[model samples]
Target: MMTCLCDAFFDDVARATHEVLESLGIEVIVPESQTCCGQPAFNGGDWASARQVIRHTLNVFQGDCPIIVPSGSCAAMSFHGALLAHEKETDLPQVQAFGARTWEICDFLRNGLGIESWEGRLDARVAIHSSCHSRGTGTPEAIRTLVGSIAGVTLLDFTQPEQCCGFGGTFSVTFPHISGSMGRLKIDSVRATHPDLLVSGDMSCLMHLNGLAEKQGSPLPVKHAIQVLRDARVTPVTVQ
Candidate 1:
């Protein structure tokens, strides 16, 4: 799934995900009617609107094919979040089936495709920020395994690798001061590692961190892990 954040602010991330999936010989199918996974409303305690949006999405993504989502937050919402919305309803069965077929892209690539290693090369000291929503979903481990498998990429160590980037969908806006402080702490941890690039499974987290980094004048470089893997396939031509 192309998340709202990715589609609006980071189109390249979705493109890179598409390219990487195709390179692995996976035929991707994106339904044109697909839209938000109802996360914003769900997180905001608006269940009526959330169910409306979730129903529309479920209709768009019908069938047994695995629904691969680039953002762990959205993937979780589509399945687990949707199930909660329809908990007492008769549609719960459908939501459970949908949950069974959903997967975050990295998780899909690692466990779904059985790809333990990527032979591509990109020499850089990389630090990872697995999204808060990715916890318990196996995305963190999948990211470590996949990124570590890249030949020349060195995974850097940093404090609080599990800390949230403070972009909890509407949580940031609801509590900007608390959100900003949390984000700064996360950035400080990453900066201490002195890595060449900051990587994450979620573009939303990167967007939040990138804004704080620029405001603080540190401006650390960042990219989605899929973009790193896609770029690693190429040979960089040096200008003479």
Candidate 2:
């Protein structure tokens, strides 16, 4: 089972991930019954809606195969925080069990499945933004390890690499000015790295940073980490 805020983001990520896994001869079963992990509702402080989403998600993926999510925010919600929020609910036991089996996709690849190499090469210096939700879920190291596996790639350690890009979904809507300021700070850090590309696990954060960079005419391009790994066969074009 995998979950995200919307179907489009999830489908894109799932497509990329499925390509990678199939290339590596690892088969994955994507349950069509899965829905949003309810992080939006949870983050928005709507506990009841969050619980409802969680309950439906658990019911859908209760089998032996582990739940793998592409979004760190969604994974963290189901893996660590959601159970605590609905602890008093009668379905607490089921929620807790589901949480235990949830794994971020990178973590599942690098740790659970023991994937140590990729088939593509970008041959360029890159900087990685460790999304806050990914770090909170303890999967940032997994991302780094997976990125490191690509040949001809250098993962530079930029300043404030782990800072939030301030695109917390609805948080950006509620506090646009603050969000813009925070995004600018992240963009500055990425610029300082002089990377050919910027990569992160979360699409929302990447989209936010990419928009800011485009607005300022920054040369660096943004990509999801999975895209980087899956496209390792082709050299990335240098930004002018």
Candidate 3:
């Protein structure tokens, strides 16, 4: 099942995420019963609330099938929260099983399916923004390799590619000014290469960076890596 975070609701960054999966002949299902992975609660020192949310999530996503998440942050939350929030060893086994089956969307596509060639094409230059969780999970490398598979996309390089965009969930809210400043810096670094679009595994960083660009009256288009891979602009397949 695919875990589409609420963050994708606004601009629908993941509008074509499922379509891309299905295009590859993979079955995709997202349980409407699912909610937040409790990353916020866990990060804010509320283990009890986090544990409750995770238990509900586990119940909703019960299956041996892998739980695929679009956001690296949410993916990390479920994988780590399972172990961190559980107090008893009895609960540990179940949560651990859930974590073992969880796969970040990019990881699932690039590694899980062993996708070599892509029918979708793009002619734009792209830059990658690394999320903290994506870095920890080594998803950025896989993402780069996948982007390279595209026909006409040129992934650009600039200084400090691994730097955080400063949208550390609650950290951004509690420290808005600092967060905004860091975002500006991150965008500045991105703009240094003057790419046509920026892509990342997480929407939070994209939102933060894109919001800052808009505020500064700069035009930095941001996209989730999943959306780019979907390549919805590809010519439609004509049927007989």
Candidate 4:
């Protein structure tokens, strides 16, 4: 199947996602015009702007291939945001069609392809910081299942594992104080683990928590789960 990568451009999430697909030998193409699923606008209660944002995404991904989105947040937007975002009933068919082709990257790899386990090695301990969407969508479980398949990677369950990092797109901007407090709590929990890395499917969450981690002078690095998976697949060649 030809896969069109829905690169959400949230830090290096897209890059890591693409590498993971290629590592699995999946044929993936990124639609250059793709941008935000209008999540910030949608979550901010501006459906009008969201309609515009989603329409562009729909138009760019008009094809039969599976649209693999790296960000669970963007995947959530594509699956539900477009279908209900528009004011016009006529838009439903087109929006719904686009959603039908969209899949979160991890979901696509695990369920779509029936990949129960992976073969690779990574000695570092890690924590998964699930996006708020994951708590409801079961994305964290999907991620955990995949991460556990790796040979040497240790998955840590930090405190309040299901809590939100407080980066609700525009919600963080509209309500900074509450957002910061929630972010610190999240970072604190992850820091307490002293893991080498904190990982998640949403770059938005990583960007938020990573910024706070840096401020607190914590040494752990934040990354998309895909990066960890991608790196695991590589068998390092010793010096000949």
lDDT values for all models: 0.86, 0.77, 0.76, 0.75
**Which TM-score value belongs to model 4?**
0.89
Q: How far out, in Å, is residue 25 in model 4?
A: 2.8
- Residue 169 of model 1 has an lDDT of 83
Top candidate, metric TM-score: 1
Tens digits of per-residue lDDT, candidate 1, 85-192, equal: 999989889888988899998899898988888776777888999898888987888988998888878899899876788989899999999999999999999989
For model 3, give the 10-residue run with minimal summed lDDT.
Answer: 231-240
Tens digit per residue, CA lDDT, model 3, 29-125: 7787877787788888988888888889889989898887878887877777668778565788889889888887778887788865565678778
User: Model 2, 44-86: lDDT tens per residue?
Assistant: 8998888888888888887767777776777788876788778
The CA-based lDDT of model 1 is what? 0.86
- Hey, what RMSD does candidate 2 come out at? 2.3
Top candidate on lDDT is: 1
* Per-residue lDDT of 240 in model 3: 15
In candidate 2, position 58 carries an lDDT of 81
What TM-score does candidate 2 reach? 0.90
